[model samples]
Target: MLELSPILPIAWLLVSLGFLKMPAYKACLIGLAISGIEAISLWQMDYVLALKATLEGSVFALLPIIWVIVAAFFTYNISLHTGAITHIKQFMSSLSGDRRIQALLIAWGFGGFLEAVAGFGTAVAVPAALLIALGFEPFLAAVVCIFANTAAVAFGVVGIPVNTLAQITELPILPISMAIVWQLAPFGVLVPLLIVVTITKSLKGLQGVWLTTLISGISFGLAQFVVAKYVGPELPAIIGSIFAFLATVLSAKVSPPLRDWKFPREREAAASFAKVQA
Candidate 1:
């Protein structure tokens, strides 16, 4: 059974996500039925204990997952019902005409702003869906939003993690911020580059203005260092990403005409362009 813990996860994945060919809801029901029946058959505990375990397991399973999904659908519904989503896309498209810029604005900047507020899956789903609505491919939008959310995860909720660390460690806020930057500065440097690499595939994404990304990373890294060094802990995330985003504008200004630039393969572009035309 000790060994089974990892194996059980594999079996669970196979049933829910693979061979069952069932939707998530149906898979969940099947899993619950299997667990309940197995518990009874194995006589793992007294009936009362089994009942308690079952209830506990269900609550553990549902609460956080349900909270995330409920919050996601709620934000999604707000976008649909209020039409904040429309204005949002207009806001994004107007920011940059390039599809890549649209991805960064909607997924990174806007997504970071939302994550700063909501701190949940809404950060990704809402922005990615917005990008998709604005004519970006779904997968591309998801990838960028995921990258954009990283910068904010550490300090969002008005710097929750720093606050918690300060409280527990009884250290001053600056040191905690310093410690965070120790790990976060590298993470910040990597994400923007990762977004480019993921979208275009290979180092090919770095083809145009690669130095600009490096310089932008330097700007962000310096901002984080300053926030960790002189500025208060509360400001590193918002300030760092803002500086980084602004620095990218330099790349837009300096890079060669994008049409002349090459990506991994021509066939892929033709297929993608065909889809866009369709």
Candidate 2:
């Protein structure tokens, strides 16, 4: 019974948050109450020690995690209000008309940069909004952005996640960051290709743009690996994203997509017209 007591708070949290659809804050408070009670009654913990632990955790979360997220959102909102985001959207749109190329640029490259800088939700939200503005289907844009966000999250928000892990594990930051990048490198290389696949809704989407997509992914993965190995966690995502963006642009210049590929409906219409002509 005592061994199972610790699971009660977690089970209540899952039930309240997942099944009952309670607000996160409320569910957390109730879970905290349950934990406090369990610590005091079941574990026979001293009240002062329990209180001290709770206070320390609350302070740590407030100062490091919550404040950082708040600051990131604040910066994003300021950019939005000042029309900087509009200019950025315009700049991205001007880069390429091919939807596949644009997906690589915005979702894979720019989204990774956003994760490096602000993180939390900025990477997914900003890139999805840009894709939607570029005439991508809303659902597809969101999905592609979500897919592209996977690997970059390791070093997200100036590497807070990695730093926090190091602190918790009492490990050196450099080795931890390097190991994380090494593990994530394959995913980093594949996520860009996956984003393209998601955006096009078919493997045929890689028809002509496969080379460019591969270049973007390789550049991103290689840059991240180098930075994480030599520099640290804070700069890997940022440097990797920049390298990916520049490499994609250069590759496109040298060997652009063989044909301008749009969404499924547009491609079908073009195919039908070609068939009629033939």
| Top model number, lDDT | 2
Off-target runs (Cα >4 Å) in candidate 2 are 1-94, 267-278
Q: After aligning candidate 2 to the native by TM-score, how far in Å is the CA of 51 from where it should be?
A: 16
Lowest summed lDDT across 10 adjacent residues in model 2 is found at 68-77
C-alpha lDDT score of every prediction, in listed order: 0.67, 0.84
lDDT of each residue in 53-91, candidate 1, tens digit only: 878977865675457656665776688798887887676
Q: Candidate 1, after superposition: displacement of residue 185 in Å? A: 2.1
Show pairs that collide, candidate 1: none
Model 1 stretches with alpha carbons more than 4 Å out: 1-22, 26-94, 254-257, 260-278
**lDDT for residue 144 in candidate 2, whole number 0-100:** 89
* Candidate 2 global TM-score: 0.68
**Quality of model 1 by C-alpha lDDT:** 0.67
| Model 2 whole-model lDDT (C-alpha atoms) | 0.84
lDDT of 2 by residue, 1-278 (tens): 89899899999998998799999899988998999999999899999999998999889878765775566556556767887767766776566668888888988899999989987577777777767766788778878888888988878788888898999999999999888888887897688878877777789889888999999999998998889888898999999999999999888878887777888787888899999999
lDDT, residue 118, candidate 2: 80
